[model samples]
Target: MSFDGLVTRAVTYELKNKVIGGKIQKISQPSKNDIVLSIYSLGKSYKLMISANNNEGRVSFSNEKFENPQNPPNFCMVLRKYLNQSKIIDIEQYKLDRVIIFHISSIDEMGFDVSNKLIVEIMGKYSNIILTDDNFKIIDSIKRVNNKMSSVREILPGKNYNFIKSDKFNILENFDKDIYYIDKKTPDNANPKELLYSTYLGFSPTIANELCYRAGIDTRVNWGLVSEDEKKALNKNIIKLRSKLLENDYTPTLYKENNKFKEFYSFRLRHLQYEYKKYDFISEAIEEFYKVNKSNDRLRQIKNDLERKINSHIKSTKKKITILDKNLSKENSMELYRKSGDLLAANINKISKGMNSIRVNNFYDENKEIKIIIDPLKNPWENVDNYYKRYKKLKNSISYAKKDYPNQIEYLNYLLQLLDFVERSDSINDLDDIKSELISNKIIKDSSRNKKSNKEKSKPKHYITINNSHIYVGKNSRQNDYITLKLAGKHDYFFHVRNAPGSHVILKTDNFNENDLISASYLAASNSSLSNSLKVDVDYTEKKNVNKAKGSKLGMVYYENFNTITVDLSDKPKDLYKRIQ
Candidate 1:
């Protein structure tokens, strides 16, 4: 899984053969941390991707599609100024370290010839893509590190580019036998694997383990506690390793678990064994690994963002509904105001002004005596009018709340439905559809709406039931509307989860039997928020009996003459012919 020294060497070898003479045709910074260069060579095109992401930095030949921003980044523009249309004359690796350099030739503004070196350092967190002239004076870099950022090495313009100095000797080029001797005074606590790899450039831990294993030396053994015979075996294997690497006899291999990639290296790693696949070139293996990993990471980020936005709105909606419920509770006392007013009106003629309360007979309650408290500063009739006015105000407020509560609840349900959609989405396209729905509903702001919509919209997933009947499940709100309102036949059966946000599922056959209906119900339940419920209620009715609510949101509908089917999700079939293929 590590993009180690050998992997870098292999990628550089392939890139040299394919792109040495290629012209830099396009330069794009698809993301802030990555760049893709389109190269034209030997009557063909190639994309060389350079990534500076801390966790997943690499230099590889990639054909993966990366969407570019509408405005090119400043570093991208800087690269275009110097490298655009330039021919790559040479590609070199820096002493087998994780750094690659490109010697480029181009014509300047005044028709003067210019030579440049574009350096890519693949160190983990300090990775960078730097451009400099032939004298090594820096031009600009994809990532700018000022003095405040790193006092050890400042990668900025107008500064001399410095190689990260390492005291380690080259294992192949400068092989010294005296350094390998295990002396009585040598340190006895260091791991043999660590000692070998740390003492030489381009020697990885895995390769060191292999060397130790091949020499009959325990990789866990202390480096200073080796015997003469074991040292001889180690020397023999190290020489063979040098010969293999020098001769470019690498076997590009990738280890996998359950068809998912786990580890990859330029050569066969003899120290470890697992289920693996071999490729003709290391670029292929490396590209596929990064593509899948990067895509998964990107999707997770977006899903979290959308989930955060939706959950915020859902929280606010619930709070608003709680406040409205409290207001509605005031309706309980509205009748008291009306009754107080009635009692005061009857006692108005018997009372004078400035009386705090009037004692009277309550004819409405079996003629029992009742007391009505009033404003002593006002006449009895004036107090009666004040009570009446207060009662009418309470009536109006309760009435307004009664009418608005259902609408607010409906909107809250709609937001909940969108949240469910966000969780079930598996692809960027599905998420994009949901994002567009949110923007259209004014729930989110996105400027991409002004972009062209010439791309055809994706459709719902269509499936074939066990009875050879057809079923469809919408993946988003737009598709839900398309399935229920535009695609379904009037006699077709409509299926949905009864009190939850779910996909709109439609059965496209009227002559279907019980099994067909159940299959449709299964689709509806599986694609819903209630998919994991022990028992799920799915309502099914003829499409003609379902009507979209007037002035309501998309996919919001009411149905009558429907039959409910109880589905036990634990009894789901292994396969219901879910796809047409």
Candidate 2:
């Protein structure tokens, strides 16, 4: 994007047709690494930008606007001191390089006629603009490269003025230089494309490609592959590119479709009829490429993560179904005991109603008579039939529990498994899958309202660690029940802080020594309500000994046997054991 050569050529043509006078109306530094000059010539204002940014640095009459800094930097101050209100005498290019030297004549503070020069170099990373006095002594540069930052040539004040490298091809005034340069042999083993690109001036990458493509020769082909015909084609492309450069005819036509740049293809001004919206082509190309690449990467990561989550959900759901099927085969002894109690009550009711035989002793002061009586039966087998009815009803109830308990368990297990998957989900798609499953199973009445939370909800209270193989404290009432009764093994030692709302800790083993009890108690102390203020008091006992109150909340329990121990809440509960998985 070096437009210095083009601008120089345009200025040379304009110098012949217009008044030979121009004055710098404004000087500003719009960025940390750029300067703008507003020059007035022939009653028209031209805003020229000279940038020393690491990339996209060039000198051209820009149509774009920039925000100027309130306080100029030191480099800006130095340029303004010498170049303000200076008259432009000439604008010239160095040999054939992208360097542009602006010659200005002005009166100094001493009221003496003086000449000063400002040089704009449009090299990629090494770009800079240097200011020099009447004697060609360097004043300063936009970027001062030192040994620490760069190993290349350093640009500093008080040095003699010189170009970093000369471009040999910008020799419009020298006929001999142009005619003899093409016959020169390039370096051995050089890529034909690379040699053509660097040796020929003002050749864009696309034009270079067109040259190689038309010749049926690879750009990366070795120098030895350069036959007479291929060389002739390359030479032709070079001359054409240079002609355009000398004419200052760089009205760039981007190969854009749907407002996206396809490529930079060669097109004549007449061939391009479409109204293409203009942009800072160099900057836009780089920025859009990065933006598109980043979006694609994010999309790829989301797809991979979703795939992993779905597979894990499927495996876990199948496991829960298998567990439900296994638990269904267990005999419900507690339910059977309740049914037996009901049967005993029914038989007693029949005797009281005189439907069955009964024996009673009436106590009196004078005499107590013991009598056995039976009601006259409509049928002799009625009493036997009645007893069998009660027994059969109890048996039938138990059979019903046996027949349907497994199915109910499977249904409940599926609900819980799906809830887990829903909680683990992050994006909308994952939530949608969970919502669909919930609706299919009738777990939720309304699928639209099945989302977990729009506002943040409190997290689950219980956490299990493999380090000590213990269930740590619960954060709330619901988690207390979940960890103590549901997740805890029968043999796991349970601990609680006496008379305190704390977690029920399960030590994962029954045969624990005094040290294990103390360690678990410490964990119970750290996660309690009193954790911030004082050392905690803990009580512990077997879970079997703890009983839930008849009307108590889910986690509230009353115990028949327990012991108390006080522990400091100094140690972090999570630091107890090293291993965790």
Q: When superposed on Cα atoms, how far off is each prediction in RMSD? A: 4.4, 27.5
Clash pairs of candidate 2? 96-170
TM-score per candidate: 0.83, 0.44
For 1-581, candidate 1 gives per-residue lDDT tens digits of 77767677888888888999999999999999898999999999999999998977888888788899999999999999999999999998898788999999999999999999999999888999999999999999988999899978899999999998887767557566333553343587878788778876877787778788888888767866777788788888888877877787878888866445677788777667678779988888888777766666677788999999999999999998897798799886888788888988877788788788878888778889888888989887889899899999989888888888988898998888898888988777788888888988989888774655655556799988767789889988888989899999899989999999999999997577987877888888989998878889999999999998888887788899999999888887656557862
Candidate 2 Cα misplacement greater than 4 A, ranges: 1-20, 147-152, 166-189, 201-207, 214-216, 243-251, 257-581
Computed on alpha carbons, the lDDT of every model, listed in order, comes to 0.85, 0.58
lDDT of 1 at 554: 79
Question: At residue 342, what lDDT does model 1 achieve?
Answer: 91
How good is model 2 by TM-score?
0.44
Of the candidates shown, which would achieve the greatest lDDT relative to the real structure? 1
Q: Model 1 segments beyond 4 Å from truth?
A: 28-34, 65-85, 105-115, 133-140, 144-149, 154-159, 174-200, 203-244, 247-279, 349-359, 371-382, 447-452
Candidate 1 structure lDDT: 0.85
